[model samples]
Target: MISYVSRRLGTSLVLTVLVSMITFFLLSNSFDGVVRSILGTAATSATVQAKKAEMGMDRPVIVQYADWLFHAVRGDFGISYFTGQPVGTAVADHLTVTLSVVVTALLITTAISVVLGVLAASRGGVIDRLAQGASLFGYIVPNLLLAIGLVVVLAVELDWLPATGYTPFTENPGRWAASIVIPVIALTVGGVANLSAQIRGAMIGELRKDYVRTLRTRGLSPGSIVLRHALRNAAGPAFTVLSLEFIGMLGGALIIENVFALPGIGSYSFSAALQGDVPIIMGLSLFGVLFVVGVNLVVDVVNGWLNPKARIQ
Candidate 1:
């Protein structure tokens, strides 16, 4: 297991570095052009040159990427051009708000998916049809639509919840939870729908295996057969879906955040891109790359443990 983890970690680190380099170089190159287009006739060549030098854009792409990577290793994510604050510090301040909604969404998604998936697989007639219909609705509707619909019905018409903004849990946990509840629901609904469908598919596939027939002949309780025997075998695919969903929650979801006015890394990245804040954009992209790589590594390790045969392969 240790060997497996180490190998996967090494590979993930390399991928993270590559992603960071690509992101840095692309952003650095685009920054000048974007800034130029916006500045146009008002900008002088000398002023632009000076700005480039100041932003370290005068350096080669490799050197710029290396410098950023070095500072990142030391937990210095550079200063935000817009805010004049440490990028890491700004991200740290907002992480709690983002995580509150994301974690809640993940938990809800996982719990609801497991129950609905198992039920759908166990009962193939009306129950399966109902589960399929619900999953389809959640899967087919885009998150932006979901967010807008939720805000309209729940916040505008019903006045049951706030439509936007984040409150720190430290101040008032109840209100903080209340504020993010809609966002969480919007985020998790799609994930739960996808996960449940995958779980149902895996379960159905596992049920067709000869071993399941043998278990039935052994007179094992139907519950034990499904939960203990079938579920263990069916979980591999569902696990992948869960991992990808978690990684996605951390990085993207900008549309949802924008629609709901939720303060998160997603909105920060969006703003950074819009303003051509090279440093912040690079920093956020690097952070996202690391997060995704780390999540993938963890998923690989978990999958390895769950199926020892995979380790041998």
Candidate 2:
């Protein structure tokens, strides 16, 4: 298990480095454009040169990347070109908001998907059909559309939740939940649909295995056999689906954040890209790559725990 974890960590580290290098090079190649955007169209040639040199754009790409990576390892991402805020501070502020919605949605998705999936697999009649149908409907509907509909019904019409805005949980937990509910629902719908389907399929397959029959013959209760045995085996695939949903939620949060006018990394990154804020962009890019790598590592470890065979693989 230790060896397996080490290998996974090594792979994740390598992937993070490769992705950060590629992103740095791609952005560096466009340094002139970024500098121009920052300085404005009327800036003189010498002024641009001075600005570039000041920002270390005049340094070799590899040297700049090495320098950035060195600081980044110590959690110093420099200052945003546009906002003058430390990149790490800016990203962290927004990250909290994004994580609140995404993580809540993920927890809800997992619980609801598992219940629906297990029921559908075990019952296999009207319950199954309804679960499948709901899954299909969710899969068909785009998150943006659903978010709009939810805002109209729950926020605008019903006045039950806030349509747009965010409140820090530290400030008021009640308002925080109210502000985040719609966004979380929007993000969760598709995740629940996809993960529930995967879980149902896995559970069904696990139920049909010879071991299930043997367990039944030993007079184990149906609930015990399914919950303790079948579900455990089924969870391997479900975890994979859940991890993928987490990554998808991060991407989806970008649009959801804008629609709801929430402060999140997604919205911040979007504006940073538009303004050609190299420090902000580079910091966000590195964060995104590292976030994905870290999530994948967690998923691998969880999968290994669920299925010992996965550790060997």
Candidate 3:
């Protein structure tokens, strides 16, 4: 297991380096050329060169990537071009807000999926129909529409919560929770539907297995057989889906954040791209690459633990 984990980690590290190199060179050259072109020929060559040197544009592409990798290893992601703040500090601050929203959504979605999935699998007639209908509703509703509906219901009509903007958890935990609650729900509804579908399918398949039939013939209690034996085996596929969802939650939730006006790395990246803030965009991209790599590593370890056959393979 240890050796397998090490191999995965090594592969992830190498992939990250290659991705970083390609992204950095492309961005640096593009930005530098733009800057030089905009300044014109009469513009001070010395000043342009100085700015290039300052931004590490004057370095060889390999050297620049090496420097970036070294700083990234040290948890110093350099400084944001637009924000003028250290990239690490800026990302850390906004990331907390995003993390809170993502974690809350993940928990809520997990609860909804697991309970609904098990119930739907076990009680297949009208209950299964209703669950499938609800899942369809969730899957079809676009996130922007869901977010807007929540804002209208919770903020405009009822006035139960603030419309948007983030509150520091330390300053007022209650308001902080309230501010993000709607957004979390809006982000997680689709995830709940997808996960529930996967979980329900797995449970149904597990129920039809020979081992489960053997248990029934051996006079095992239905509840124990289903809850203890079936659930454990059924969860392997669901676990993989959920872990992949976790990684995607960080990078792919831009629309939800934009709808709610919650400042996060995704939103930050979006804004930076629009304005051609090359440094911030690059930093955000690098952050996402690392986040995905870390999540996949974790998922691999969990998968190995859940199925020993995976390790053997």
Candidate 4:
């Protein structure tokens, strides 16, 4: 297990570095524009050149990347070209809002998917058909459309929740929950659609194995057999689906945040891109890559725990 974890960790670190390097180079290609955006178009050519030298853009791309990476390791992501805010501070502030919604949606997705998947797999009739049908609808509908419909029904028409704008949880937990509900629902529908289907299929396969018949022959209760053995065996695939869902949710949050008027990393990144704020864009890229790598690591560890054979693999 220790070796498995070490290997996964090493691989994650390498991937993170590679992603950062690629992102840095890609964004560096537009450094002249970023500098001009920072210094303003009215600035003279010498002024722009001076700004580039001051910011070390005059150096080779590799050296600039190494310097940025060095500072980034210490949590200093430089300053935003437009806002003049520290990149780390800006990203961190918005990241909390994004995480609050995305993480809540993930928890809800997992619970609902598990219940629906287990029931559909075990019951195999009307319940199964209904679960599959619901999953199909969710899969087909885009999150943006779902979010708009939800806002119209739940907020504008019914007035059950806020239509837009975020309230910090520190200010009012209740309002914070209200602010995120529509966004979370929008994010969760597709995740549940994908994960529940995967879980149902995996559970069905697990339940058909010879060991399940033996467990029944030995008089194990249906619930006990399903929960203890079949579910545990099926969890590996579910976790894989969940990891993919998390990555998807992060991307979805970008659009959902804008739709709901939530001040999240998604909105921040979008504005940064429009303004050609390279530092903030690079900071967001690093955070996203690291976030994904970390989640993948967690999923691997959980898979290993649920299936010892996974550790060897």
Tell me each candidate's RMSD, in Å, in order: 2.3, 1.5, 2.6, 1.6
Q: Compared with the true structure, what per-residue lDDT tens digits does model 3 show for residues 1-313?
A: 9988988899998988888888887776676654565455566878788877776678788787788778888887777665578877777787888899998888888899998898889879988888898789888997789889999999999999888888889999998999898888787888888898888899999999999999999999988888898888988899888987777666556877777788887787778776666657667878888888888888888889777887788
Query: Candidate 2, clashing residue pairs?
Result: none
Candidate 3 overall lDDT versus native: 0.82
List the candidate numbers ranked by TM-score, top first. 2, 4, 1, 3
**Candidate 1 lDDT, tens digit per residue, 195-248?**
999999999898889999999999999899899989988888899999988877
List, residue by residue over 1-313, the lDDT tens digit for candidate 4.
Answer: 8899999999999999999999989988888888888888898889989999998899999999999999999989999877789998898899999999999999999999999999999999999999999899998999999999999999999999999999999999999999999999999999999999999999999999999999999999999999999998898889899999999999988899989889999888888898888888889999899889998999999888778988988
Name the 10 consecutive residues with the lowest summed lDDT in model 1.
32-41
TM-score attained by model 2: 0.95
In the predicted model 1, the residue pairs found to clash are: none
lDDT per model vs. reference: 0.83, 0.92, 0.82, 0.92
Identify the runs in model 4 with alpha carbons over 4 angstroms from their true place: 305-313
> Residue 151: error of model 4 in Å?
1.7
TM-score of each: 0.91, 0.95, 0.91, 0.95
Residue pairs with backbone atoms closer than 3 Å in model 4 (clashes): none
- Give the alpha carbon lDDT tens digit for every residue of 138-215 in model 2: 899999999999999999999999999999999999999999999999998899899999999999999999999999
The 10 consecutive residues of candidate 4 with the worst lDDT sum are: 31-40
Candidate 1 lDDT for residue 169: 84
Error of 1 at 133 (Å): 0.7
